[model samples]
Target: MTKLRIGIVGCGSITKYRHAPEYAHNDAVEIVAFCDPNVERATLMAEEYGGKVYADYLEMFHNEELDAVSVCTPNLYHAPISIAAARAGFHVLCEKPMAASEADALRMIAAAKDSGVILMVGHNQRLMPAHQKAKEVLLVGDLGKVLTFRTAFGHPGPESWSADGKESWFFQKDIAIVGAMGDLGVHKADLIRWLLDDEVVEISAFVETLHKEDTEVDDNAICIMRMGKGSIGTLTASWTYYKGEDNSTLLYCENGVIKIGTDPVDQVIVERTDGTIDKYDVGAMSTNTGQTHSGVIDSFIYSILTNTPPAITGEDGMKSLKVILAALESAASKTLVSIH
Candidate 1:
């Protein structure tokens, strides 16, 4: 098959360090264009990635013969660009949290459906080997009836990962919409839902800017979630993890407890009530500085090439976004928010 002509619409740290380089390494993909309001950044990326630079993504979308595009821009621009790309006949690999709001995310999904294009979200946590193995184990009923779960994703701050560091769009409310909740929390929301195969029905949360100074968005969030029928969990996303990155999920089941990403050498561990411990080495989770193939870029390309719906479809993204939006509403209103 011919290489999938690709374009990326953001020159930020994620696009620069993660997305662009991965696409460059994929023999099945060809980087054809780069777009960012920051022309210098786009130009510099184009120089390295072999693409045309554009300050306006709309212009690039219309001009390039792209089979697909990655909407890696600031959170606010996600919906508009993804929608436009769908309408322009390009499959979309939009960076999560799908959009700034539920309405926008829904609109993006509708636009993709109407345009007959595949739309995928960049919730890569689901692609992690440990998480995948955990889901497989859960499906086989090895852990009888998941009772509850507690998951967390926290780091020093986006300043360390943002292309602009402290001044990155991640710290700006207008650009990022919500802070750690949107950035780190959405990943967990997508994760727990995928692992348990249950949607979050309600959420109560505390979203705050506890540590970061002069930030318009929250630096931390702790969410209590009601999943499907009866199972409950707590999701914590924080930018104040000064010690190191902590990304782990603990699922309490009737038969045993399953720990994922909680151990250094052992990535997935199952401790049964029968007094037996099972361990599986599924490799390490990808970090900002880690040099692992995110599987996301490859998966997106495979979906387009194989003419199959992406694993993380637009609707899946919408559901995850709904959870985050509901959590944000709950935090703002100081009440439990229901997801409809």
Candidate 2:
């Protein structure tokens, strides 16, 4: 079997903790190149992954015969980098939020289509055992007729993850565009869209700089959404959680209410009309094993080997990006925004 040669474009925490290590374990992938403006970071990653290092991504694409590449760069670079990779005749697995703007997202999509390369997005949450189980339960009607979705995600900030801590690009509007909404809300939005199997048709939102003493972007945001099927929902994202990660969702339906999140205590809780609450440790069914990278990487490898579309595609990324961007627009304008 010919292993797909992969070139990774960023040497950040995500690349270190997620993509690179996952590809290392996958039998179907051979990471052949790594690039980062910081030579030390690039060199370190290359040494660990047994890949050549390059300071410029363009140079990596020119030198390596890659089958695919992961765009793990910042929001602004995502479109241009992925487009360049697609034109280089390599498939793409870009990090989430797609791009800084809708126009950029569309341009990347066009480039991928023009290049005839598979463009998958790194919405890793979709591959989680808990999320996958929730999707299954909802899709299979186990939750009965879905009525509403209330989701929230908050975790202090990415200071611990970035090289520069609070001084990281995440705190700069020029570099990150927006704060919590861009950094974290995108994932929650994508998950809600996927689990509901519905498009967000309209949105009203507000974003404020409730924290992060030095940043110009909002540290928190709250959004209200109306899905295509008339289901109403609420989404909350913040960089204000004192400690620990919290990404959870609750769905109210005709027959029961389902709750899901990253809780060692409980994953899925279903409340029935009989006044009996059933609890399911959905994480126990995990192929996850507290290892999201492995599961996502395995899925990517399977998709490529089977010549099948990824569970999260560029199109899927764009749809979710639209909602996030629209929320930003709505927050700025202080009005409801149409998502069409």
Candidate 3:
């Protein structure tokens, strides 16, 4: 069994906790190198993960005989790094929102297409076993026609992860792109789309900064979406939560309501027409999410070896990104925006 030689771009906290560790743990992956503008961080991660480090990812691409790389950089750097890696004949697993803009996202996709290498996105939410099962249930009509869905994803803020303590790129529009929407809301958009098996057709939103001072991006955002299949959905993301929680999704169907998350209540519930109720703790599924990234990395390696589309392709990421982008536009215009 040959291991896929992998490189990692950007040695940030996400890279440290998720991407690098996931790749390192995978039997089919050998992390060959790492890149970051901050050489010390990159070097530390590289040494810890058994890889060499470089300040420039392009140099790593040029020098290493790698089969793939994870672009775990800031939103602004996603395109260039993925494009370069793909052009250098390395499959790319880019961290999400795809890119800062649609044009850059498309370019990265095109590069991977031209290179004939796998272009996977780290929309890790869809990998949750409970979320995956929810998708299966919805697809099999266990929910009996989706009527409506609601989801929310947020954290306190990115200050804990950012190098700049309180003054972080998360607060700056130029570097961060958008705050809660891009950072956390995008995951909700992706999960909702995956579970509902539908594309968002229209959107209306409100985005605002409620707490953070001297920041250009919204700390809170709410978006209403009309899916192509006539299912309406609502997404809320914020950094204002007094307590920290992970993502969760809810759906109201003709048959029952499905709920998911770390909340102390039922994880999923089913109510039959005869008034009988079926409840699943879904606690184990939360444990499953712990291995989601590892599953993703193994799946990526499997896809490359088998010559199959990744579990989450660049197109999948793009569709999810479009929803978030549409939400942003709708929030800015204060109107329902068509998601064409």
lDDT of each: 0.91, 0.84, 0.82
- Candidate with best TM-score: 1
Off by over 4 Å in 2: 284-291
lDDT of 2 by residue, 1-340 (tens): 7889999998987788888999998888899999999989989998888989999999999999999999988888999999999999998989887898889989999998998888888887777777787887777785577788898888778787676687888888886888888877888889888988889999999988997888898899999999998889899988888765678889999888888874566787778766878766756322211335437677777777788998888889999999998998998899999998
Candidate 1 lDDT by residue in tens digits, 234-339: 9999999988899999999999999999998889999999999999998998876575678899999889888999989989998998898888899889999989
Q: Candidate 1 vs candidate 3: which has greater lDDT? A: 1
**Predicted structure 2, TM vs. truth:** 0.95
- Per-residue accuracy of model 3 over 222-321 as CA lDDT, tens digit each: 8888999999988999888747655778888998877777445656566666677766664443321233344677788889989999999898898888
By lDDT, the candidates rank as 1, 2, 3
TM-scores across all candidates? 0.98, 0.95, 0.94
**Model 3 regions more than 4 Å off:** 282-294
Per-residue error for 219 in candidate 2, Å, reads 1.0
Reference-based lDDT, residue 8, model 2: 95
